[model samples]
Target: MTPALSPAEVTINVVGALFAIPIVFGIFIKAPKLVVFGFIGILFCFSDSTWGQLETDANIYSRGVGMFYFSLLNLILMVAGVAALLKRLANPQGPQLAPPMAKYLAAFVFLLLGHVVVGLMQGIELDVILGYSGIFNVLNMMVFMYLVIMAFESEKDTQRLLLMIIALATLRAIFGAVRFFLFDGDTANPYRNFEGLDIKIFYFDINDNFVASLGAFCAAWLLTTPGVKLGWFKRGLLIAFLVLEVAAVALSFRRTSLIGLGLMFLFLFLRLPGTRKFMFSIVAAGLLAAVASVFYEHRLQFASEDDMLSSLIYDIAPSRGIKDGRFYELYAAAQSMDGNWLFGRGTWGTFSGDRERLSYHGDDFSFVHSGFGHVLLKTGIVGLLLFCGLLAAYVGFYMRHRNSLAGYARLLGDAGFAGFLFWVPTLLVGTPIIEFRTMMMLGLVLAMPFIAVGIRNYQVRAYQYDPRYAVA
Candidate 1:
């Protein structure tokens, strides 16, 4: 029998249900903004269990209960998505259908389903296959994206979505900062060692880095982008939020995030109109100087034998290249893909041969450190091609349509494009593709360009129909 809940737990559950009922009703009513906000908020707030972590929960009765609830949330979103789609189809005046790039994404989803069939033919157990196939969560995110496109009625809806993301992301950054500075009641040496690895647990999940990076880029875009007219007070608040987000990324101590930040700036520099480029450069340099001064002050106060700055510098340095275990793991995964390079070893595939060193939790080799390597290991060159093709399609679509946008739409388009660029380094070096939270965040970023275009087109059409509907 399952254990009974305590009185406090019961009360908490009742309160949660009360709130959830109304939220579900709103979703059923085709509230796109509500659904998008709730979805993104949950992804930022919750952590998903990895396969290795699931192995450790074998003795717990409620081990997978969180995921069960998450599935129900996805189901609700899907039902509402279908309804929204039908409603739009029935009304010719509704928001336009999915953009052209969606077909490429659909093809990628089909390829993932084919991988599942291949997994079954390779004799992998159903449970193992389901557990290892992170692509399912990716599909869920895509559905949510479709719902976003369908349900958002105007450019204001997209603007509000961006605002909600910025607000939530800022809160997350603040929370992470508090945890890093005060969680252990230590002013210095705010890291804990698990086994031999020293990890600074800023938040409950590694995906917080994605949130911080996205928020930082968006804040910077709002603050620096030309034609994005903001009051001095709003600009001041954005500047403060941007600082917090940059600090949060640094405190998280993820090298991939630092690289992603650099790439984002590079993308912004190259994509911005020539007239705005100089302004952006000035703002970017000032922000960097501010962050450096803040960190330098903190380092001075917390300088110790085992200081945080030294550890961060050491981690960022390239001296640990060949000595890193992930390098060996990547090598092992590459060697395992020797014979099955065409279609891959399927979804539930594990690295073959002596992978004792690469194994997590002993004898488990289903997950790898490198996202590209993991894709190659499981789906082979063809799946890799499909994945790359989808990314390329988004880039092409964004470039082709970005010029048509103006004002806030254009600001969001540039920010979204830069945010997506930020993920490139993470996808190549980090295991984001297999991580549910990271993939959901990726889906959101991937949908932004399309959303921006939709907002632009909607406004253009509305203005064409009515003189009063002209964009401000």
Candidate 2:
């Protein structure tokens, strides 16, 4: 049975609500676009484990504090969304929605709802699926994306959003750097649990790497792009942030994140616009290499005394092959196809019948680690196809419309492409699908094409009326 909250807990809950409600109101009323940046910021900066640990440390272990925080955040978002909708209804001049993107988002939401029904039919407890399957999280992401598109129609708004991303990523990088020195012992093993200030904030080092790397990629985009004015101070800040982000990835000591970061830079190198921009890329590469060299010894020691670059090559080289949980997860997914191949198992369902059972709201199941395996196991072949189809559609759409994007939209599209490139390969070894940042990255890619087109059309109409006025 669930326990009731104590007096202290009740006061905490009430205070949380009071603080959250005003913030939500202010966001919707004063600056709706800020909501997008705030959501991404919180997700990148904090995680469920952080929340859980805080609750445990507070002597309130009946439930996690993270859940309450998340619920409050969600409530804030919902209230903001409702206010936006109502304002639009009351005033016809409100921001317009993208019909095509809306349809796609709606279809995705329907698929998620269908999966919930499938989970229920498979005898998975509704609460268990709700808690773990992440349906709400996915829905919230979709809504956030839609709202971003509506709220951020101008190039200035997009630039502000990107700046917000860079600032948060800088914070993450500094946090990681501090933790690297303070918690260096935990760097010996990638999988071991290490409690530190940074780990408590993000739950894992890979996340720190992921967030910072993407921010660096976007910053690189803005810095290298043609006609974007930047004073020396701003340019120095961007370069410094990029270098720090690269250093943070090295400090993560996670081979997958480092590999992902490398691949993202390669994509950026190729996607850069022209000779001048490519020249800038050369300089950026040199700076990053210099930063990596500064930490070479630490990274080498972290990776079993092998040089960091050499270790990367040796690990990913085909001769190393697949081991660890990757092989086990793939084998488990393949072996689970006997009885229920169509809808293999519900959320929290697993193939490991022999494994010891752990209780989650009175339900027990094993977890598939790989993203592909998770989809195949939880929703089966049909659901896997749907998920894959959505991804393919987004990729196809992005590729088709990539060249037409202008200004900040083009830069964002490049970042999205680089992110997708990095995330796709990591799925073989990790469950990128269940991750909030990965989904948000995909949301950006999915929404960017339409947002780009909208910006272009708006510019064209404005230019037709007044050619002397510049449009961005």
Per-model TM-score versus the true fold:
0.79, 0.76
Model 2 backbone overlap count: 0
Q: Which pairs of residues have clashing backbones in candidate 1?
A: none
- Tens-digit lDDT track of model 2 for 75-144: 6666776766675677777545655445555665576667678778877666566543443445555666
Instruction: Estimate, for each residue in 1-472, the C-alpha lDDT of model 1 and write its tens digit.
Output: 1245566765765566557655665664655667667677787765453331212322121322333433345445556666665666668685555566567557767877786676688776555565534445556556666666665556777778777778888887877677778774212222333232244445434567678878888877776666778999998998889888887766644456666776787777776779889888887777655554444343323333445455434433356574454466776777778689987777777775454654452666776776777777877888777677777877888889888888767767777787787788777766776665677677777777787888888788888999697776
Q: List the pairs of residues colliding in candidate 2.
A: none
- In model 2, the Cα lDDT at residue 144 comes to 63
lDDT scores in order: 0.65, 0.61
Q: Tell me the spans in candidate 1 whose CA falls farther than 4 Å from its real position.
A: 1-26, 47-70, 77-96, 121-123, 185-191, 195-201, 271-279, 286-325, 353-356, 359-362
For model 2 the TM-score comes to: 0.76
